[model samples]
Each structure stands twice: as C-alpha cells, then as structure tokens.
Target: MPAKDKMDKTKMVTCTAPVNIAVIKYWGKRNEELILPINSSLSVTLHQDQLKTTTTVAVSRSFQDDRIWLNGKEEDIAHPRLQSCLREIRRLARKRRNDGAAGLDSTGLSHKVHICSVNNFPTAAGLASSAAGFACLVYTLAQVFGVEGELSGIARQGSGSACRSMYGGFVQWIMGNTDDGKDSLAQQVEPETHWPELQILVLVASAERKPVGSTSGMQTSVQTSCLLKHRAESVVPGRMVEMIEAVRKKDFPAFAELTMKDSNQFHATCLDTYPPIFYLNRVSQQVINLVHRYNRHYGETRVAYTFDAGPNAVIFTLRQHVSEFVHVVQHFFPPETNGGDFIKGLPVNHTALSEELKQGIGLEPMPKGVSYIISTKVGPGPCVVEDPSQHLLASDGLPKECV
Candidate 1:
C-alpha cells in the first residue's frame, strides 16, 4: 500500500563536465557581473576520468523549496552565479513552451529544482572547479526542464572560464566586442582525436583555497595593473592566432612556448596590481626552473609548465616524454614515503633515471613539495549519465544516501 500510494512524480537528469586549464589565461573582466573577459583565452580540456564535476538536477512538485547540495552539504541556491544558471534555464524552457516545441513538460517547468554537484577533485584546489561545476549545473538543469542549445553563453554568466568547459579538446573563448556578449562564446579549435599523444600532468603543490579569488584579484589587476591592459590590447590578439595554428599543426614546441609565456604574463599582471598579488611560491619557482633545465638538457622543448591562480603546476608534454619527465619530477619532489595514490589517472610506466640525465640538469631534491600527480589526456565535453543509479539526488528530491 505504501509503494502504491507514493509513486514518485520527480523528474531528474545527471551529467559530468571536465575542468579546463587555460593555456592562454583569462584574468581580467571587462564587465564584472556578466563575466566578459578582457582578453580571449585558449585551453585543453582534460579527461573527465581524472578530474571533473558530476551534477544531478531533480524537479518535483513535492519539494518544499529550490535547494542545492555541494559535496554532500547544503548550500544557498541564491548565490548569484547559481541563480543566473537557474534563471536562464527556466527562461529558455518558457520560450520553448510558448513556441509550442514538442515534448514540452509544462508541469515540470512549474516545479522547483534541487541540484547536487560533486567534484572528483577537491573544490578549492585552484584547479578550475567552478568552470566544470557551473557547466554541469546548466547542462543537467536544461535536460530536466526540456530546454537546450547554446548554453555556453548562459554558463559564461556563471563563471568566465566555465564557457570553455562546455566543449572539449582544444577550445578558445573569443572575447566579443558586443555589449550584450552574444559573440563572446567558446568554439572548439580541434576535437579530442586531433592529437592522440598529448598528455597533461597536474603536479599538486597544495590542496588549499587561494588567498585571493580570481574575481576580486582580477578586478584589482584591471583597475591597477597597466601590464594587464597592454597584454589584453596589444599582446593576446596575435598570440591567439599563433596558438590556434600551433594546435592545428600539433606543434608541441610552439604550443609549449606560447602556453608557458601566456601563463607567466597572466601572473605578471597579478604582481603588477596595486596591492600586489602573489600566486606562485618557492615550490612553483622550483618547478619552473626544473622544466627549463629539463628542456635544455634534451636540447629541445619536451615539457612545458603552466600555473593557474594557485601554486600547483599543470605540465603539458607528449607521450614520448611522459615517463622520463615524470621521473624527473619524482626524483626532485619525492612523494610521501608513507604511500598514497601518487599518480591518479593513467599509469606512469616505471623508467630508470640515468645519472647522466640527472647530473646534466642538476637540481636539489625538494622532498614532499608536490603531493602527487594526475596523468591525463585530452578528452570529450560534458556527458549524460543515462543510468538511474548515477543520480546524486533521490526520487524524494533529497541527496541520495549521501554520507
């Protein structure tokens, strides 16, 4: 009788989105609230298996109010970015209904939604969690409300970097000149299959929240840093063209050079800010020095390093260079002796480090500086989880057995 009486009326959809590391960083915002960037940026979307956000959205008439749970904890649904994503999805659904699109769920449209999002990686680790987070939220919500198409523009309103995570492979976010930001959207320069051997490694320096968030930090840079203005106007345009060509040709050397330089300049602008922001520490500088020495030792650019808003190093290298370069890293920043998942994703084949190679690039070992590394490669965009059991929320519209 209980089962018969309580047939669930909830509708739900679940999806996952990968985090994007900006090779050409997006630092300053031209328009703050809309998240319009001062300069366009390019990035490689890493595989979801290693790092991503999984979100589930549920709509039910029985729910008391619209709510959300982030990593098994309740959070305010009215946070501006979250609110923007929720509002836009509903608006699109309303338009589809007014236009009489087939399979319209008018009843579900009126129901409140409960959103649950969890990341495969740590939330405040400065690994672009918000980008994947918002992208997944917008995507799953669209599926629940029966509205879809061109959601990146809406995702951009949630987080600037988020637009890039809407697609996979090599992506570029074109900073549009229009006031309404219609043209400012993400475009895939190449699909994941374009380059099979390209690999990404995340050298975790620390798993902690940044002292300053990107929004406020960049705002200070925009107002105070002249380097940022010059970089936006005179530098990024030409670099965008060169970066796109490098990806198209699979020119690792060219791509590596550009990626490293852009990352440096982005951090440079941060230092030039009035109060002066510092994202890199002693560990970061050591990693940068090691990368240069390694390339010099090989007489070519075999590896490149980029840093986001935190101290962690995101290294880009080809398959041929992976084992040796990883060997270099492990030798310099030895993992904990107690044991952990030192490498998270693809297995790193054990390779011997020759004395000739080690002494050639001479650097003092900095034990335990890096927590671990995540070995991954270019991967596809956001995806749907068709299985019912994957849902993060239950038919009762609460977190589904979350511990």
Candidate 2:
C-alpha cells in the first residue's frame, strides 16, 4: 500500500448507546474485577433520542498509540477498565482470525486506535452515563474490528450496568455463579416495542457529578452494608422475578410498585453502609413524596420514582399520565425557566393542574428543585451510525469537536 493510502486506511465505526434505569437494582459486586454483580438486576433502557452516548473508534497504521477523548477532554487511555475492554476486544479479533473467520483484518489488529466519546446527558450524575459510555465504547470498537455477538459481557467488564445498556427495553443482568464470569451477562427481557404505553421522565435534580461514584459506593456497600448483602442475597432474587413478569405482562401497577420499593431499598442499603453514602438530596426526597402522593390521590400506582447513585429521579408512568405527572412535577418543583425550557426530548402536552389534585398532595413548591425533565420512552439498544458526519472522531484520528 502507498504511504498516503496507508495513512488513509483508518477503519472507523461510530455507534450510540442508551442509558438504562434499573428497576431491580444491582448494588454490589461479587467479583469487582470482572464486574459480576452479587444479584440479578433488571432495567429499562431509555431511548437514545433523549439520553445516549455517541462513540467513534478509529484504527490506523499511522497512529502511534491507543488514545482517547471523552466529551472533548483527553482522558487517560491507560485506565484499567478501558484497557480491559481494549484487551478483550483485541483478543476476540485475534481469536476470530485464528479461527479463519472471513474478512478478518490481520494487519489492522496491530494498529493503534483513537477513540472519542460524548454523552448527551450528564456523566456521574446517576443517570447511568458510564453504562451508555462504556457500552458505546465496546460496541463501536467491536464494529471497527469486525467482531460481533454477545458483546455485553465485554461491556460489563467496563461497567456492571453497561451490559444492561447493550440491549433495549427491559433487560436483566444475570449474576452467573461461574468464577470466570462467562455466564454473567445481560439478556433482553423484552424488545423496545414491547411496552409502548409506558413512558419515562427523568427529573434532573442536578446535572452536577454525584458526591460518590457508583464503583466506590458499591465497594463500600459490599464491604460494610449487611443490608446490601441481604438485599442482594434475598430481596433482589424475588424482585427480579416479579419485575421480569411485570415487564412481560405490561402490568404498570405491579411494575411501578416494584420499581419504587426496590429503589427505596437500594438507598436504604446506601444508608446502611459504614460511612453512609448520601446519593439522594432533598429534591430527590421531594420527588419520592410527590410520586407517592400522586399515586395515593388516584388510589393506584399511576407513577413511580427511582433514583440511582444520584439525586436525579427517573419516573415511570403510562403515556396518558405523562402530561399530568409532568405538570405535577412543575407545580411542586417550579422551574426557573419557562415550561418549554424545563422539559427536553419528546414534547409534553400542556395539562392544567386541578385545585383538587394540588390540595390532595399539598406540598410546598421548591423553586428549581429539578433542573429539567427528559421525556423519553423505551428504545432500542446500541446502534451503528452509518452516517460519516455523526462520527465523533475526524478522519485524522482526532476529536472533531476539539479540532
């Protein structure tokens, strides 16, 4: 190959992965290195249209070493989790080549790679940014290397919940008993189209990074929180079964009840930790109260709130209730900006808050408790973006945004 051709021979792929909200949460890891959860967990993958991470990976002979840029800032490519993902993907590619898999690029395997990833949502704010980020990273790299099939296990090595983001709609991360962690993988419980009536509203209490990261939080919980151990060993198994059944049956009430209970329990375990990690702020507590009051006034579970390792509340409700629930949120947590600015993603119709409804809940308005709300629904898993313009990295193996 000519020098110019060799320089131009960049094998690149770009992909987007969705953030996921766990209903039956995964709190602790049995094997920290492998990211094997202590218990099974189920989650709903939010639509990429609302929340996603886009990643581009390019491999070329001209590149000197593995490099990475995240959200326009250069990050340490030598990070262990990153190296784990990179090593695994290369191992798979080499294995394929050894097995005489068609279209295997023998030379490209030795080339350096440039990676650029950015999230539409806030990172480390408990919105599962790492889930989408690492999922996109592993996925785009796999596509670039001509590798495919069951990449969730590899994504898990990067972030435990990342495996769940590898699939759309309802997903369950099975905590396999194997020491090698081969059986511990994500499996889709249902496709994106399975629950069209169900809608999700991410109440962004704060976009700022959480006080404690999930990795560190989970580590502490595993070591100190006996509640975490019991929940993982006892509660999660039963809830996982119920959650899966609720998702399959499209039982909103059952699903909502389980979601709220599991979320509450997850946080309780956080409190039970030796040092006690506080992920939820006053805003999160208010959201939780509002959700229950809203459901109570209706004498049923119309809405449910779940928080991860941050103050942001992820609410699940039916499409019909979205307008009213959003309005309710607005009434309680009055935004600093206009309604249009307060809500992002899918448009929500204006719904008048009735005096009866307001009086029933009777909560004092907290101005700007939530920054904004992201209205989205169940959506597909990681997807390849064929459009060259969508690539985060330029043809020269640098972040387009930075350039």
Poorly placed runs, candidate 1 (over 4 Å): 1-8, 338-340
- Candidate 1 has a TM-score of 0.97
Weakest ten-residue segment in model 2 by summed lDDT: 3-12
User: 289-389, model 2: which lDDT tens digit per residue?
Assistant: 89889888999999999999999999999999999999999999999988879999999999999999999998999998999999999999999999999
List the global CA lDDT of all models.
0.91, 0.93
